[model samples]
Target chain A: MTTSKSNFSKPLILVTNDDGIDAKGINELIKMIDSLGEILVVAPDSPRSGQSSAISSGYPLRLIPVEKKEDFTSFKTNGTPVDCIKLALNFLCDRRPDLLVSGINHGSNAGVSVVYSGTMGAAIEGAIVGIPSAGFSLCSHNPDANFSACSDIVTFTCRKLLEQGLPQSVCLNINIPASDKINGVKVCRQAHGYWTEEYDRRTDPYGKDYFWLTGQFINLEPDNEETDEWALAHNYISVVPTTYDQSAIKYIDTTRNLFSE
Target chain B: MTTSKSNFSKPLILVTNDDGIDAKGINELIKMIDSLGEILVVAPDSPRSGQSSAISSGYPLRLIPVEKKEDFTSFKTNGTPVDCIKLALNFLCDRRPDLLVSGINHGSNAGVSVVYSGTMGAAIEGAIVGIPSAGFSLCSHNPDANFSACSDIVTFTCRKLLEQGLPQSVCLNINIPASDKINGVKVCRQAHGYWTEEYDRRTDPYGKDYFWLTGQFINLEPDNEETDEWALAHNYISVVPTTYDQSAIKYIDTTRNLFSE
Candidate 1:
């Protein structure tokens, strides 16, 4: 683990989220980074989960000012995770951050959820911009999720990154379980899992129809100890060094031959 | 290539999309697959790009009928890409299809766009459900972009999948460049590239300020011919096997070593 460069220059930290400003999780996260460096937040005005890296192609984004404290100015934006990052860099922040941390998301972004996590989308956008970043999420979905256990780990991880510069083209996804105690941090791989979907139909007050989508999660590799799931389940903070490129390098050879003329 | 399955029930081809039923893309796609088999479309009522493999962790999904064309049934749903696949398999479709096809997406889902594409999400969901699937996209953003060139290859690809079943946990991401004279199909890897995001600031008619995000696509590996970008540049349909496991398997050794006490 290489440490982030530490000169006299204060590290510029860009903070954003999928959950809106009122989210207690982000509040707790903000407290942890108070003394680290300068902070600027431009998060979504409302929760935009399962939005992935979606950018508003039709509707324009609206950035509104939110409460700010010393060295911590915040704004709420009507956009997706990707939109928030774009706004932060191109409009809000003068320069890129030493780190861009998203979430402290309301729930787990482990396994397949990571692919669809707005929190992660922001982090990946930061990595795309050549900035070392991470997305942190608690396993609890409660709006007032007790983030007591995650604060120390979050601070430790950020401090570590501030010490050891992260590897290029990679962002970290740190998901902590909903527990009173954390075993420690474990660098692990994304667990293999997916959701089984179901649709419930209903009628509106005006006789118009509406639908709500819901589902249950299924993990294929439940017993894998080297996975993020194992770490999270065992009350440890799981740090998965995630990459944006989803290439199947190992099978490239076998696949190339399959398409050969 | 091998031929379609010789004697079982006519090859069942499941059709779905990220675009709603009214979307010209899905309509064009369904028309293309009209004669392929029993075509059942379970798509969103609106465009859902960048949805990835995210699911509706909310209320039950509502599957609504959109339009009924002769031998083609169209249904609208309030769900994500993964939702459409799960519902089509567990609730809607009578049985798993020999082939599941998603998109002739209105825009390019090439390069790094696959990570955020709801189109590919649907296809990946199909693979997870033990069904062979393929996602097709046209490198055009025009509302009425011509898909006349897509016929021969799509039919041939469908036949190929029906014959030589795709490898497990694999689905094809076929990105067709916007050109009439294509150099045939090229099997390639995803190009390492990203959008250099730029946000456009705007003020609404109301006295309030806001921001709109925009960007230009930049290819990092401009000279790499083994990538999807090169295939697109050469005016060929790039068929890259896109995966979602997103496990940094190669880096596991290094990362695990970092975690060692």
Candidate 2:
């Protein structure tokens, strides 16, 4: 594995989240990582839940400077999570960031949820751009969820990533189980799970129709102990090394056979 | 592998796209697949480029039935690609769809581009819902890009998928090289690649700053023969089996050791 070029005494850390610039989750994350480096916070201007890896191409993005201090600086954008990373790298940051830390997001981005996570998307984008990155999510979806219990693990994991670096093109999806007391940490694979969707149909004053999106998660492999879902359910913080490559290498041969004439 | 529960003589197929309901690409796809089964088209109301796997959670969604006929039905929604699938599966469809097909997308969804594609998101959502699914893209950005050469491959592959069910939670990402004449097909891996991003920064007359996102693709492994980018470059229709499990299993032990005390 190639060593990352993050050798400076004070690393440049880019921070972001999907829950908007003013959310409690991002604020908790800033409190944890602020002392470690020169921090630049570039995040979305409003809540962008389930944004995945979206980039806003239909409109021009505006980056508004929010705050600036000796050890910290902040900006917000009228864009998605991926757009924050792109805007920060291209226009906000004077140089490439050494570390990218996203979230302390309100909800768990474990298992299949990562695919719809704006928090994880920012960190993935950072890894794509050759930065060592990690996304932290508390398992609670409540906006006011307390993150004090997660502080120690967050610090430990972030420091380790800054020190050891990561495999090229890989980032960490760190999910902390929601609690007031700490448990241990676990390195696990993303669990096989899916959302069973239920749409609430409604009508407008003019008798036109609409729908609301709601769902429940069903864990396909409930007995599997090596999955992020299991780890989180057992009250352990789960860290899954994730890659952007979606290729199912094991299924290639069979797929080729089926498609061949 | 479990056989899908789509045992009827005629299959029920769900069609959607990221390029909005009236785009030429989706229309061509509807034309290609309309005869294979009872088809239902549910897509975004406006262009949703770079939407990835995003879902709408903050606002209520609306699915408006636009066209209904003997062989086909269509709806346009004010939501992202994934929202279209969720709404269709939950309230729109009479029963679970036998298959889900998204896009003859206006641009290529090859290599790293897949991570930012709204086209693939709908297919992934379908696979999550236990349906055989595929996302098709033509390697051209023009709205009116000719898809005549792509129709044959689209028909062949979609038929094969409907005949032989996909592995659980796995879907196909198919990209056709832009050409008048076609080469054969290739089952390939997602190529190692990244975008070299450059933001075009601009200022308004009021001196407010805004930026436009633009980038060029950089292939990391140009000589690798088993990759989607290479297949496309050589005029082969590329089919990559894509799964939602982002875990880099090979790196699990090393990651565990790093965080271990």
Cα TM-score per model: 0.90, 0.95
lDDT of 2 by residue, B15-60 (tens): 9999999899999998898789878788999999899999898899
Taking the tens digit of each residue's C-alpha lDDT, what string does model 1 give over B1-261? 011123345677878777656677777887777776777777887887767776665455666766564666566777777777766676556656789999888888888888778889888877766677889989997879998778776777777788787776788888888889998788888887777656566667987766555677799988998899889988989888877666666666655554453
- Residue A112 CA error for candidate 1 (Å)? 1.5
Q: Indicate which candidate wins on DockQ.
A: 2
Task: After superposing candidate 2 on the true structure, give the runs of residues whose Cα lies further than 4 Å from its correct spot.
Answer: A1-8, A68-70, B1-9, B68-70
lDDT tens digits by residue: candidate 2, A78-194: 999999988888766666787899998998999999999999999889878889999999999888898987799888888888888899878999999887655788899999988
**Which parts of model 1 are misplaced by more than 4 Å?**
A1-8, A197-211, B1-8, B57-61, B257-261
Model 2 docking tier (incorrect/acceptable/medium/high)? medium
In model 2, what is the error at residue B222, expressed in angstroms? 1.6
Q: Would candidate 1 be rated incorrect, acceptable, medium or high by CAPRI criteria?
A: acceptable
